[model samples]
Target: MNQFTHINASGEANMVDVSAKAETVREARAEAFVHMAAETLELIVSGQHHKGDVFATARIAGIQAAKKTWDLIPLCHPCYFEVEVQLEAIPAENKVRIESCCKLAGKTGVEMEALTAASVAALTIYDMCKAVQKDMVISQVRLLEKTGGKSGHFKVEA
Candidate 1:
């Protein structure tokens, strides 16, 4: 059976010790989707929403969330990283697609940071547009790619 990295021999949860690990350039990319009604999508794409610049708000939220991931998640090490978040209003799909990337030179990977960024960005969109549409659904949050660290490189298969 595979052992859990956050568990100890005593079956207690604990943060992994990465002090001995070598620091390297690590990067991770993650994605999320927020599905909504056609009218809601139209409001976002047409830039007529009263809330003002949904994409810009979401982008800032994602970047802030990435930097604070260590504080939000238990057992995660504090890391300094650069983050980029992009959100697109896809009217054809009636949804907003969010992609986030986090990069850092550190002992641990930045996958969690990237994932958190994407998730928060999606949530921010929902919060901003709830007055216009309350039934929005956030889904398909996943890590799309990762590079560096001991794991080397990984990318989702098309």
Candidate 2:
């Protein structure tokens, strides 16, 4: 059976030691979807929402979240990295899609940071539009791709 990296032989949870691991260039991308009503989408796309630029605000939130991932999630190692977040409003689909990418030269992967960025961006969208639509749903928050580390590369199948 495969052993859990975060679990010791005594079944106690612990942070994985990466001190001996070589620092290498690592990159990860994550995505999230915020589903909302057509009217809410219109309010955002038409620039009629009182909240100003929804996409821009969400993008900033995502980037900030990526940088603070270690503080948000326990056991995550802090690393210096670059992050990019993009948010698109699709009126026809009645949803906003967020994509976040994090890169750095570190022993640990940045998948959590990417995922946190996407998730936080989605939540920011929902928060900005909550006054207009209360039923907004956040979903499909997952890592889309990752590169580097001992595990190599990974890409989600469409």
Candidate 3:
């Protein structure tokens, strides 16, 4: 098995040194789900939420979060990348599905950025809708796929 990258021989936590790793096109995609009441979903979909433009606000928040992932996470390296965040409100499921994709040509992976984007996006949704629904649940924050670096390509089977 491969040893942990962030741990030195002395077992102290440290950032992985990707300096020697070749610069490759790295991309990562992540997803998050926010479950809420059907009424709350209707409020957002119908544009009747008092907060105003919930989707737009959440989208902006996600993008901002993706850009600052390196600063937020202690070990993440700051690298330029393109980020896309999409939010879908599923009425039948009474949930909002947020998906984020981050891509860049760098020595390190953008998985943390993608995951951060999705998670913060979900949180923004909850923050906007909390007035109406206090019990909203943010769940299933996960990495859906990643490509590039030594790991090559990965996609969740289920």
Residue 62, model 1: lDDT of: 97
Compute each candidate's TM-score over C-alphas: 0.97, 0.96, 0.98
- List candidate 3 stretches off by more than 4 Å: none
- lDDT of each candidate versus the true structure: 0.95, 0.93, 0.95
Q: 49-152, model 3: which lDDT tens digit per residue?
A: 99999999999999999999989999899898999999999999999999999999989999999999999999999999998999999999999999999989
Pairs that collide, model 3: none
Residue 54, candidate 3: alpha-carbon lDDT = 93
Query: What is the number of backbone collisions in each predicted candidate, taken in the order shown?
Result: 0, 0, 0
Q: How many backbone overlaps does candidate 3 show?
A: 0
Displacement of residue 54 (Cα, Å) in model 2 is 1.0
lDDT at 59 for candidate 1? 97
Top TM-score model? 3
lDDT of 2 by residue, 1-158 (tens): 76788888799988999999999999999999999999999988898899899988999999999999999998899998999998888878989899999999999999999999999999999999999889999999999999999999999998
**Model 3 Cα shift for residue 85 (angstroms):** 0.2
Candidate 3 lDDT for residue 100? 97
